[model samples]
Target: MIEYLIGIAFCLSSALTVLILLLPSQYDPATKDKPSVQILVLGDIGRSPRMQYHALSIAKHGGEVVIIGYKESDPHPDVVSNPKITIIPLRPHPAILQTSNKLLFTIYGPLKVLFQIAYLWKCLAYTAPPSRWLLVQNPPSIPTLAVASISCFLRQTRLVIDWHNFGYSILALKLGQNHPLVKLSIWYEKTFCKSTSAHLCVTDAMGLVLKNDFALQAPILPLHDRPASHFHPITNPQERNEFLNGFPETESVRSSLAAGTLRVLVSSTSWTPDEDFSILIDALVQYSELAAAQPELPEILAVITGKGPQKKMYLEKIAALEVAGQLQKVTVRTAWLTVPDYARLLASASLGVSLHTSSSGVDLPMKVVDMFGAGLPVVGWNRFEAWSELVTEGVNGLGFGSATELTERLIELFGDDKKLETLRVGAQKESTRRWDDEWDPIVGKLLGLT
Candidate 1:
């Protein structure tokens, strides 16, 4: 069945390639004053920050950008208000895909992909302005990579793939690595990815993997994730308090914070399989026990923010732990905050924790970058090789191998104000390095915007 589907996809792609070549050019002579670049994302535009950043950066460098993606949530205000940036929202998948039984996912999944392929092809080839370049996000690489590559080929546009992680590796988390679907996804990614004009990866390790393993011929640049300008420390006590009080969840903890009896710990998650929230839960339980025994240790207000599939499960576990008296000293609160509010929450926090253990060991967590930008020292899962690229052992942040190790690190930092202060200083220094400074030179040159 998989083989049959692959054959059909190949035939359809070949036909589309021929059709696109025969179509009239989309280039408009009137709009030639500035270069046009299309930023393509298969996911929600607002949720996908890196792609939005790309659009913003291109616009900043005198390039007109047409961002094509699902507009599920409101994107950054700057992106919306920018004159050079135009967003073309794709129609969402059928509601039946969401409402259907899990047993029928196999039937629905391919149908959805087919819909996406047709819609995406129309947007890229016909709907959006003719572009000099098309920058696309990976991990929804299935049809996007193939479709974008072919469209770029036919239109003579440079196809630049921004690799976050291997789509196959992520699929393997659900279906084991040896599964037929996973194998097919691997083949699809490798086959289409090689056709891209250039590559921009999140980590150096990822670049190495692409070069050594995938044997990609294109020039691969490791464009590490950096925090945007909005993510900065709120140094003023009054400003921090005002922002904290604005949120109903943080309002209850204000008295404790004012009394100097509580320490705020922030964690951002997508509640995905790659991030093991169990480790955090267990660590919090241990910390609760330690705080109970050691009176000097401050109570913890753990603010975990983000929307995801596993959120309800984790929330239930936290509630159960609290009821069973396993989390007396730790208060685990989950929230879904706007981007600006999230940054402020991180800045106001005493420390940040990251549960992301990368699906592809080469990819780095953007959450850590955001935390560093907000001047909060992070305690991250250090099992992956790419963790070292973003986190230094004792410099800006700490890395933990297990729940016990995370618990120890948490206690050590909260117990000693001097140690935490030193790390915070390092984190603050990291915040000075913004995204535009790095992006403009390398990416600008790649897109010919410079």
Candidate 2:
């Protein structure tokens, strides 16, 4: 009887030991496992404010973000700063492959996507799984995208894509709509949108376009590409004077620069005829005498910053209008800004301008958001839903149908100090409220770290 009892005890102990070994000791059922999220931001790192905002938000949220970026003229902050972020630089993919990728991205895209699949396979095998993965809209590289898809499958990870711009629409505009490239881009967008967990767009209009055209069930999140505050406002009277001194004007012009002058600032990387900056210039001219009538009119300066395709032509236009004397008063600064510096410089301006001639509705411009953040109002065309949703005419800012209307409105806004102050305060309030309520929440949700 004693021997049998000993044998039963030994067997029970062995069984309990085996069960303990099978269970994961490291796993605690009650604790929420911190998901390992690895995001690959593949794009022109500096050019798009959306990319910057997305990457930074993810990093700030405590995710491991890696950037595979291409260098343009400016160096991006996410590439250099943020301890959580790592950047992998590569040579610009050949334009031919880019073209071919667009071609294959459609019906046959998956066929060519094998290269990306193989690349992703290797990446996943090395990195191991259960990590969340993503690829933001970028150079439109089919291979990299393929890799993302394959990596997600192999690793059993969730995949998300932030499609900032409609590459197909851009191609159709730049190239003909009937162009093969346009057709292919549309096709790739469809497939990619269908495959991803979510596709983030910059505007509601764009999201509508995707859903209506592709019939994609993928969830769409509207995320405008804009920098977080880049520069501190130069409110100090002394600092403003020093900056003005750097771009000195004659006493006549200096007197033209008055304190209350509704200063209009226009800056961009490049200006094509499509931008139609002449509208702003003409408006400045119309309000010039009126603004001059006020003590602030002398301070009413129109500063056009950055080099663009229209640089020479616009310079000629400035000269012809005799705004050249005003151009000296107008600060045409070169495009040299860290993201933060650019934001600060923009905040100092009274108004943000989105003067695109193309009728294709306003994709939410980063300038608008930056303007919002800085408490500056936007003077934009009224065709865009985004403009309507954000700006209330004569409230937050004014949107117009034509150059004449835009100019007339500018005259009214700048002429009245009470109205201008009202708009400025409203703009700052609206910007802060929108950032906290709308954009930041969306960013938090997208990161899945909310």
Candidate 3:
């Protein structure tokens, strides 16, 4: 009887040990073993605000997120602090892959794509299952989905694609739009993209491309970029002063040169080949001539933010003109800021200006959205139909067709403080619409909740 009792006790102890090993010890009651999502972006997250925002959106819902993207500055405080989120940064891309030189890009593009696929396969293998999702940021869509679809099938993981613009269109800029390889890429993207569980696009025009051109099924969501929760039109007087004082370089210039009456014209550019920063440069130059002739227009200081391949070239051009004293009372300065600094700069601006026209002719420039959220009236370059939703001519803001027209608009705005004030009020009112609210329904459906 004693021996039988001993045998029963031993078996029971072994079974309990095995069960404990199988259960995950890290599950939070708030999350309740929600599946982990891995977000993949083939480019720098610093440049891809939408990807970072998407990761934050998932984390806010009490699910774990693992961001797999190229290295960038630390994300928001909330994103960095969340225990449910893990960031895994990849090394930067080789120059050959990023080159605009068509011959080198064509030679090495496929090789780079293949390498990322192999690396992703290894990462996805260890991510435990039972409702795993892979949210792939598309634009480099074809190569990504071609490999990602196979991994999703093997792992039985669901796939979600957030399409920003067609990768082929960008490649066409380098390799010629009609190149045989560009055509092949378009076909390849459409074919593999259909395999994803759901597709999210940036605009309605882009959704049409997916629906009509690619023939992707339902659950196609259009989610536009809005200002983050941290961004609002800061109304407190003391807070406004402190924010401007934070920028030592700009502060000293404002205090010494303009004696605290400095009128700031802030514009941000990615400095990409597609953008013509020269237009804003020219507009500011023209405005300087007007400022000098009148001697009544507040001394203008232009602060342009962001950096890219073409930045240095434009900086040199702007600097030479300043040195020669051709721009009169207007001065141009360049800043490469972290996300927080950029937000502060936007808050301090008297007026917002953006030189971007859509590279794809379908997507909206998110920079304008950021400006509008700060209650800064924009004088944007009129270029696309999608912008009509944001920039209403003579209502909230103004639009111009060219640098010559933009210069005229700037002259009109600064010449009348009352008119500028009225437009500023309009921009603040526009901020309340809240497009961010549209996110949950589509995301919920993708998560299989609704």
Query: TM-scores across all candidates?
Result: 0.92, 0.71, 0.86
Error of 1 at 294 (Å): 1.5
Best by lDDT: 1
* Candidate 2 lDDT tens digits, 1-450: 999999999999999999666432221223333334554544456665566555666666666665555556565655467786665544443343333244354535444355444544444445333355555563353555566665565455567776645556555655568987668766776666566777777677767876887687868777655436453344464655445444432234444345443364544534754467777777666655555455444344555555455677777776766744543323332344556655655666656677754334535555666667767766777775566655687787877777788767666666566776777777777654443345567757765667
With a 3 Å backbone cut-off (N, CA, C), the pairs that clash in candidate 1 are none
Q: Each model's C-alpha lDDT?
A: 0.88, 0.58, 0.74
Stretches of candidate 1 off by over 4 Å are: 1-24, 28-31, 98-104
- For model 3, the run of ten residues with the poorest summed lDDT: 23-32
Worst 10-residue lDDT window, candidate 2 = 23-32
- Candidate 1, residues 172-269: lDDT per residue as tens digits? 88767897888999889989998777999999999999999899999999999999999998778788767767767867677877788888899989
List, in order, the clash count of every candidate structure.
0, 12, 0
User: Which candidate order results from sorting by lDDT in descending order?
Assistant: 1, 3, 2
How are the candidates ranked when ordered by TM-score, highest leading?
1, 3, 2
Lowest summed-lDDT stretch of 10 residues in model 1?
97-106
Report lDDT (Cα) of residue 177, candidate 2.
Answer: 81
Q: Top TM-score: which candidate number? A: 1
